[model samples]
Target chain A: MTLALRVEHLRKSYGAVAALDDVSFEVERGEVFALLGPNGAGKTTSIEILEGFIARDAGSVEVLGIDPGDRQHLRGLRDRIGVVLQELAVESFFTVRQVLERNAGFYPHPRDVEEVIDMVGLSEKSDAKVKRLSGGQQRRLDIGLGIVGNPELLFLDEPTTGLDPAARRTTWDLIRHLAAEGTTVLMSSHYMNEIEALAQRVAVLSHGRVAALGATATLGGRDRSEATIRFTLPSGVAASDLPITPWRVEGDTVEVRSDDELRALHALTSWALEGHIAVTGLSVARETLEDIYLALTRGDRAEIDEEPDDTKARTP
Target chain B: MSTDVRPAPQRSRFSDLRLVAHQVKYEQLAFWLNRVGAVFTVGFSVVFLVMLGASAGSQKVQSLGDISLVSYYVPGFIAYGVMAAGFTTLSVTLVVRRETGLLKRLRLSPVPTWVLISSILISTAIITLVQALLLVVIGRYGYHVAFPSSWLALLVAVIVGILGFAAMGVAISAVVPNQESAGPVTSIVFFVLLFLAGLWFPLPPNSGLAKFSNYLPVRHLIIAMDHAFGVPRGATPWAWHDLLVVALWGAGATLVSLRRFRWAPRRV
Candidate 1:
């Protein structure tokens, strides 16, 4: 498969602190790749380096087969790439349409300004000055400017940070649509749900290093982590009556760990039937992406109480 | 999945030029929309011209044998107006843009660095010229100040003054820590230079202050403008020495700004 971006052994430092140390990852063409991390986790540094805004002290970075660090290749590479920075960058006085039209002139080939405006759901506010638009609307204008160039690879840094839930969903749809149309996207976000919904693959960073990296479902061995079965015992049923021995009891709720979920579930149902006790509020859950992420980044420091009481998942 | 993908077309120099033109156009639009800033840029010079003309209309300067004090003040205020547009306005705008992350965003765009700088310079030149024209119109109609005897010399001096001050503005912006500091810093430097260069009244010739002013670009600009206005006969319209001084300052400031200007805001 052709790769849209490749970063190997990237190293950057600010004085004595290393912002990125030996960070490496690859994004295949036409895939939505995510960089997930908490604040100061090197997400912005890595994105800025790939955007060609900052020079790395040491690394090999190639975007679409062009070295982003090479100045001579910048114009050609930038023509095919789009960046949505964290800050709102458009002039506050320019109307949405005007801003899009002005940015469109910078590219050799660009989408029509009207089309871009509509694509970002700003058609209704196209004539409104940027200063007059709401915060979310202004962000939509920022996204419009990014895509008006009809770029082959788009970099979105915290694109949905301040967006409301509905707007966030819309942005996710737009990103998926772009990927379906063969435009590769690299996005950084702290929203776990956003990453779970949009990213096919993810790299989690912590303390300036890759804490975990893999397909979304398999990241940090999330898919292999044990499933949890929680049920509220019927009235007059004691924890001793439960068939599962290794269970945590709180009030009337008992949580059972299961290596083989189906077998454990079958055993519990049979036990309940034999004892003539009804199980209520039964919930079977496996480790979610969030669980794996917290485990990987926080290691043993992650609060045990926060984890779904079933089985301890190994931290990557 | 295999699919045919077309290679992006090669960009041409014409596209760069077109982008620069658009940038200039937008810059002008934004400047116009900032009504308070636009007014202050030209208003200070207009206020000085009117006040000086009203108070010193009948007085005559010994250096300018036939020119009245009002006419003598014309070149000084014109110099002041150009400085306001080229230096104070440009520097403050740059500081604000950098602080607000606009410069960083522009840097990430496909537009070349030269294009962005050139567009700012072009827009400043245009705005300064308009201010100078407005001052001229007010001087003629309201105060009866005569038109410049040599338009070519006046044009040359104005162009040189704008280029020099614009470069100085960019240089000053490099030193300003943030937008809040931009106003005070630019004002302090401008007012000090304006006083030394004799904006309100001419400094006595051959005095200590006069000798010190000789090194300043504003002084040379005012001297060039005085000759351009034909106040004293036998004075050459082109003050080559003064023009050279202004040109040198412009070159020096351009170099300094190129080295010091930062696309990102200061971390602190």
Candidate 2:
């Protein structure tokens, strides 16, 4: 597959602190790629470098086969890329339709304004002024502006930071629909569930470095983590009665860590049946993306301290 | 999936012009919808015209060929109106837009940075023209101020004043640190310059203060407007010196603004 974006050894320092430290990744065309990290993980810095908003200190970066550092190429590159900034960026006095039409004029081959409005689910509020729209509606308008240009690539920086659950789900559907239509999307978000629901691949950044990068299901060996099995035992059943070799008991509940969840579940169910004891609330779970993310980022505090003071000053 | 999509065409200067036209149209629409700010922008000029005309309409000033005080103040207030729209209003709006991330958002669009800046300047020019026309109408009917003696010179002076002041506004916005400070900084700069321009009252010819005022852009703007309206300052029917001074200030301010302009918020 063709790559939509590629960054090799991207390095950016704000004074002495390295905001993006030798980061490298490639996003395939028509794929949904997520940059997952905490608040100071340099997500914004990395994305901005790719977007041509900020220059990188040292790196080889390409978007749509154009170097972002090439000022002359920026106008052409911008025509093919759509960006939904992290902030609510719209003229408050303009109506929704006006805002869409204005932004649509910036590109050579813009999507129909009405179609973009409908795609973002802002049709009903099309005539309402931007200031009058609810926070969620305004956010939809922001998305509407981003897609109005019919861009081949879209960059969404924390697309659903403050959105309610329902609104966030709608945005997720919108992103999925776009990717399905062959629009490559690069999204940065701290919400792990959002990454799980939409991203085909994810790169977790910690302390300005890619701590882990892979397909969402397999990131940081998540698929290989031990499964956790928990069940509540029937009254008068003691933990010692369980056939499992290693188990912990709390109240009437028993927990067991199992490498093979299917076999462990089968053995426990059979034991319960033989002992005439019921296993209530039985569940088998494994480490989630959030768990893996925490594990990857948890040990980077010392690296932060090792940086020179001038580099540290640029962290924020 | 088909990968036959063509690359975006190289942008021509004509496209940049078209973008500016489009942006100016929407900016005008936005300004119109902001009724309160719009009212204040234009209303301040009207209020000053009425107050000054009512109080000193009949008083004759010798430098203006014995024209009524209302006539003298007409050109002065016109200069004031252009400055308000171009310098004060533009600065405040630009600062607010920058603070709200509107400029940064625009930067992400295919619109060139120059196009964005030019569109705003053009919008302010349009508004200043409207204010000038309205002030003339109010002066003609309400206070009997004469029509401009030379329409062409009046047009040139107004254009020069608008462009110059608009550039100055953009420069001022760069110095302004944040939105909260935008108002106070612009207002203080505006009123101080207005005073130096002799809007409330004309300074005596060849006096120390008036000689100093001759070097200021606002004073030159007001004097040029007076000469264009057939109110000769002395021997000449036009104020070439004043026009040159105003143009130089405009050019200087524009240079400063272009050098210092920032699309994104400044980092501490």
Candidate 3:
């Protein structure tokens, strides 16, 4: 696959706090890549560096095979890259249609402003002032601006951060459409479900570094074959004194993990039959992205990654 | 088996220019709607015209005693109109855009920086021209001011005044914190320059302050317009020195803005 953007050992800091440290990732052409992180995890900073708006202290970054900061390439490069900034700042006086029409002029071949407006479902509100639009409508306008240039590479930074479920779903459809048209997208989102629904691959960033990078299903090796089964026993049954040595019992629930689903099922049924214990509310589920994210980013793990040298010295 | 590859299509120069023009057009539309632009245009014209009428009645008038009271105020008011539309408008727009992040968005766009700045400059220049023509018509019909004796000199002064003011406006925006502060800062500086440069009223045409005014930029611009009205010429050395000072200020403003201008919100 052709690579659209690549970063090597990117580093950024504000005073003593590191915003991005030794971060590296490659996004292939025409792929939807998501950067997942909690707030203040340098997702925005990394994207800003790629957009040519900020310079990195230590990194060799390339977008569309050119250094974005080089002035000679800015016009051409900007035309090819669409960026949806976290905060959309449209002049309160300008209409939605006017804003789109104006931004279209910045490219050699921008998509038709009216068509883009219609696509984003802002046709009725086209003539209304931007400040008058609803939050979701404003987000739509921001997306409209990002796509109006017909950019080959698009950057979406939390495009659905404040949207309602219905609006977010609509936005997802739009993103899917863009990706289907072969536009390369690099998105940073805090919503893991959004990433899972749209991304071909994801890089989970914690503190200043990537903790896990892979397909959404497999980040932190989350998609495991074995499933965990748990069931609650009646009051007469002793939860901890189950026949199965490997199972964990707490409150009235007996929890078991096994690779062989049928064998585990057989063993649990026979054991319950012998004990004359009634099992209720049994559930078996696979590991999810949420579970993986929790495992990777929880508590001291982030602190360790945040200050690896301090962690190493203390451990020794 | 045969292989054939087509060359890539090249973008037309017209296409590029059209894009730039479109961006600039949007910018001009936004500036027009901004309250400051409207307030300055209307307020400057109304207030100055009234001041001219009031001053003409109360103050001693010389130079072409035959010239009507309306004609006497025309050149000065037109000068005021140009400064209002161009310099004041440009500075406020810059600071507001900075505070609002519009300038940062522009920096990220595909248009050349020169084209962006030039479009604004050109728009303000056009607005000034329109206002000047309107002021001249008003002077001719309402106040019965004679047509400028040297339209060429007035034109030169207007252009120079625009360049000096617009550049200074941009430079000032770089230092101002936000749009609200920008308004007061620009107003204070503008009034100071106007009074010292003799925009409010003429100093003695040959007095020491008038001689020193010849060295002040606003003074040179006003004098240049006043000179176009067949007003007596000032000390040649001082006038040239004033022109030089204004030109230097303009150049300095542009350089300072270029060096220090930022288009992004500071990292929080």
Candidate 4:
């Protein structure tokens, strides 16, 4: 309902490389917003600047209604914000409960340490040394640390990057639960499904610039984009006999792309009915979020942009 | 500037002090729970004292007066304990913490830098104090060596050494590039300093090793501990001049730490 954080013309440079160039976005008090970008796309840099961990070169940045750039106000702002970095920062020797309790002491109003343990699904491992926990469990404990303070705003930079499928699903549920409980969540991820599953709105960053910003489904007008309809041609049928000509045909398959998918589908099915032909392998699908993301970023490594299995690093 | 007066996490001074105590409790837990870290930080001094005491027996060091070799060994190992805890162990731990992103996490938390720093320093002081006490007990009971004549003087020297070495610890941690090299870098620097400071054997007052190490804090801390223990027999149990030199090195190291300290991981 209210602005939790706002940035205006945010700019930062690392020597010759501009890490963030005129970045601007606003996060509402209870919205789950996402910054979708690759490795060097300035997502982490933006999060760090907002967390008061680093200063912006030139920008009017405000977090929780306080200027993060002002040194005197940073502590109070930190009290209201939670950060989960890419690295699991829990010490190897301290037990889960011990680390949580220690960090809890830093905040004026800390959540119940036991409740945080349960919330992160680490109740059974509270007394276990951090080094003993599995990677997923450790990642859960790391999230537990972030929320132990009951912060108003949560910053999660690649929260589930190295997590397995089950762990990632649990993490997504936990993030949703937090956001539903009125915690403004700002997150960055390389996974499109993750953004689609969680974020209500997203800002796609590329080369340190906001290439696209809108609701997740409608990003880059993807919802309004033309849908592709594909159907394998019936044996001995001519492509020209159809009411609408195919956009492209490869071998026996016919591809049809149109903004009026309903009209096109009707025409193709009507022709099939008249010819007593079965329209097998027929499907109509909108532009996938990954496809739109790549298009918006100007094809910033399609391999890195979409596939999590490959394209390891993304250049700035 | 008016809006700068923000809501503090813990408003009262008493509560802020409690916050540091809270962090220190976990720090101690972290150190002691790790068997290897505890052994390396505190056990080393205990093991060294017992071994050296058994071998030195009744041998006398006639450098200034006939102080038995075991008595000299006690103060020397005690100083070594302080440096090991505050300098070597602290530096390596810090580098690992920084490289692992622990420091960045702490920086992002609501806790002030002062609280985080003081908690670690206090934790280091506690480790050193425990070692010093353990060594003193071993010397007094196991080897029949007399305790420091002035316990207050020894406490002052121990505190000074802790502060000085802790500063140098932060300074050295800043130079260490990564976690893999943290141990080797700190140990190599520490062992060389220890050798020059005469930990293996007491340096004769004006020996070349003594003259050279005089400019380093390790030797000054050793001399201060020696005076507190009255190693040369009936000497003043205060070494203000030596403590001053150690304090100066600490101040210089403090400047280096201020200039070079970074919270974020270097590789990132």
* Reference-based TM-score of each model: 0.88, 0.89, 0.82, 0.92
- Model 4 gets an lDDT of 0.86
lDDT of 2 at A77: 92
Could you give candidate 4's per-residue lDDT for residues A1-316 as a string of tens digits?
A: 5688899999987766777899999988888999998667788888988987777899899888999878888887888889899898889888889888888888898999999999999988889988999999999899998999888889999999899999999999999889888888999999999999999999999878898889998888888899999999988888987778789999988999999999999988988898899889999888998998878777554222211111111111
Every candidate's lDDT: 0.83, 0.83, 0.74, 0.86
lDDT of 3 by residue, A52-82 (tens): 8776778899998878757567566887888
Model 3 per-residue lDDT tens digits across residues B166-196: 8878778777767778788888887887777
Candidate 1 local lDDT, residue B93: 90
Of 2 and 3, the candidate ranking higher by lDDT: 2
RMSD in angstroms between candidate 2 and the native structure over all alpha carbons: 4.3
Supply the global lDDT for candidate 2: 0.83
Off by over 4 Å in 4: A231-243, A249-254, A269-281, A299-316, B1-10
Q: How does candidate 4 fare on TM-score?
A: 0.92
Ranking by DockQ: 4, 2, 1, 3
Q: After superposition, how far is residue A24 of candidate 2 from its true place, in Å?
A: 0.9
At residue A138, give the lDDT of candidate 4: 93
Instruction: Please identify which of the two predictions, 3 or 4, would achieve the higher TM-score against the true structure.
Output: 4
Model 2 residue A288 lDDT? 98
Model 1 bad stretches (over 4 Å): A229-243, A246-255, A262-284, A299-316, B1-4, B63-66, B206-215, B231-234, B266-268
Q: Which numbered prediction scores highest in TM-score against the true structure?
A: 4
lDDT of 3 at A108: 59
Candidate 3 whole-model C-alpha lDDT, 0 to 1: 0.74
